[model samples]
Target chain A: MLRLPKFEVKNPSTVEEAIAMMHAIDGEARFLAGGTDLNPNMKHRLFTPERVVALGGIEEMFGITQQEDGSMRIGAMATLANVASHAELGLAYPALSQAALLVSGPQLRNMGTLGGNVMLDTRCQWYNQTYFWRSALGFCMKKDGTKCHVIEGGSKCVAAASNDTAPALMTLGAELEFANATGRTRMPIADLWQADGIWNKKVAHTELLVAIHLPKPSADQRGAYGKLRDRGSIDFPLFGIAIRLDLDAQGTIFDAALCAVALQARPWPLKKAAALLCGTKPGEESFTEAVEQVAALAAKQCRPMPNIPGDHEYRHAMVSVYTKRALLAAANGDGPVHHV
Target chain B: MRVFRLQVNGDTVEVAAPEHWTLLEVLRYKIGLTGSKQGCDKGDCGACTVLLDGVPTLACLSLAATVETSAITTIEGLLPAHRANGGEGADPVQDAFDRCGALQCGFCQPGMILSAKALLAKNPNPTSQEIKQSLSGNLCRCTGYTQIYEAVVLAAKGEQV
Candidate 1:
């Protein structure tokens, strides 16, 4: 059994209280939402904090509210299961619903939170192992020691962002609400990430992700998420892509977006590829050709590293496959293109 | 060490353990309810699965102190709760697994049965795909999942075997 290192847990009833509790014990505390990702990482001895400010007890961070403007405010503590099963969410944000559903398996989805998935730690083959396994390799730059096993003398850590929902949220142009001892602030989700894999987010540890605010989709909005993995479940994405398209009254795509993950520190936004799909009709030959171009463009832009598990070459090949499938799925208004 | 009360299997039992100890650890080591097997003590394997507020949750990832407010049902709780409700022998889910030859090695059945039990409680008649999805978190290495699937379906149908 992998014993968790000793730590005291503090359950705070509100976001402000949780933030204050974290501020009091800065750098020695981690915010525990669902404990699905953090607990396993903690068991690997990746983080041995002295205190864990549990946000599960916070009532304010547990609801999904509809805004007067048609957008939605999803609390950070909302479990992935709730988010996935939400009927309206599946209709309005199918990509997000599918992404949430595809994370790990049933039990994990029940316990994992969207906020935790958003704040998920970057993963690498040399980093996510048990202490002894990593110790034998003299550790890596992301943690413990100073070596860079993934890139060999690379100064920056390139641990892949393995979260499934990141690309979907990116495609949806989501905004994140955060709170701290100072004040509450909201920012576009895309601006929250940095290139640093050791710590990917721009926010401080003391700040709590209060909620995820998704803008109301336009009437013509459509999107889908496609995941490629060795198995149907329980495994992280070997390759994942999300697609969004908006059709004008002419029944042609006016705006489109594609974002991908499981390859880099941040979700790679394939803006150029998505732009190629504009002016193409959804069911016409032009759209099919545009999708192929988008897939090929994604294949060219996404360079899968051998940093995490799975073969880089195979992952690279699947980029085009998943990209095309996701684009098609978005057009078809179907659920995510998952093997399961 | 921290002393706290855990609402386990409908009983409010008091035990003392370290604050970081998971619910699985306290249930097995402290309370000696070893029916909840500890396989892959992280969240990967569902062998540490238990019902937290009637939802299937990974007990290995749940902190003992944090889950005190919720009703926790472990594998051992099933048969006793069944008996209390006037059922004969083991719980139907457990009995189904035993009859369907799904208990080979049995390292994963405790969690598998618990997951099935939760699924049946919610959706008494689940499709094969639903059954597969509900039990996807629990892996049975000895059996290739056919018998396990059969067991869950049999239990869901209230079959006599």
Candidate 2:
């Protein structure tokens, strides 16, 4: 059994108390949402915080509610299982729900939180391993050592942003609400990332992600998510795509958005390809031709790297396949084009 | 080390363990309820699954003090609860697994049975997809999952296998 480094746990009833606990601690302290990801990383000797502020006791941060301005407020502590199967949230935003459903496996979805998923660490084959396995290679730049395995002596850590929900949330124009000792602040989800993969988020360690704010969708909005993995369950995506389509009253595409992940440090948005999908009707030859063009463009524009554990060329080929399938699924009002 | 109270197998017990030890460690080592197995000490494998407040939760990932107050139900608690309810020897789910040749190595059955039990409790009549979904987290290397699926379907039908 891999043992976790010794650390004290503090359960706070409120967010303010949680923040206070972190501030009071002298040594390294970290906020723990669900331990689905953090605990494993801790056991792998990736992190050795002296204190952990457990956020499970904060009742105020654990529900799904709608705001007065027709927006939705999803509490950051809501479990992925709840987020995936919640009736109202799924009906309004299927891409987010589908993405949540496709994360790791069933028990992980039950224990993992949405905030944890949004704040997930960038993953790499070299970085995310047991201490002995990693130390044998002298450790990479993301951790204790200085060598860059992914980029071959490159200074920048190129671990891929492996979170599935991020791409879907980006395409849906989701906003994030954060709280700190100072006060509260909200920002667009697309603006939360940086180019560097060692640490991707722009937010500070002290800032707690309070909630995710999803704006009300247009009347004729349609969305879908596609994921390609090695197994049917319990594997992270080798390639993932989120597609959103907006239809005019005449059932013609008025707007579209596409975002993908598992490529690099950030979720790459294909705007030029989205622009090519305008004014096309679903099932028409024009729309089919346009989707093929978008797929081809994605294959050309989006490049897969060998950051995560997979053949880059195979993952590269899957870009167009997933993009075209997800776009068609969105336009046809069908479900996520995922294979079980 | 710290002392805390946990409700496990319908009994309130006080145990002392290290601060960083997960609920799985306390349950298996300190409390001596070894029914909750620990495979892939991380959250990957479902062998450490137990019911917290009647919901399936991964004991390996949950910190001991974080969820110390939840009502934990392990695999050992199932047969006794069934017997208390005036039923036969083992729980129907366990019996179905035994009769259907589902236990090849029996290492993963504890978590698999618990997950299946929770599913049957919520929906007494689950389809093949529902059974497969419920058992997705529990990996069985020996059976290849056909017999396990049959066991769940038989248990759902209220048959004596």
Q: Which candidate number maximizes DockQ?
A: 1
Q: Which tens-of-lDDT digit does each residue in A1-340 have in candidate 1?
A: 8999999999889787887889786458999989988898999999999999988888988888889999999998899999999999898998999999899989999989999999999989899999999999999999899989978789999998999999999999999999977798999989999999999899976689989999999888899999988878788888888888998988899998889999988888999999999999988999999988888889999999998899999899888988888899999998688766
Model 1 segments more than 4 A misplaced: none
Off by over 4 Å in 2: none
Native contacts retained, all candidates in order: 0.89, 0.79
lDDT tens string, model 2, A19-65? 89988978988899988888999999998999999999899889999
TM-score of each: 0.99, 0.98
TM-score: model 2 vs. ground truth = 0.98
Clashing pairs in 1: none
Candidate 1, residue A28: lDDT: 86
Look at candidate 2 and tell me the lDDT of residue B145: 90
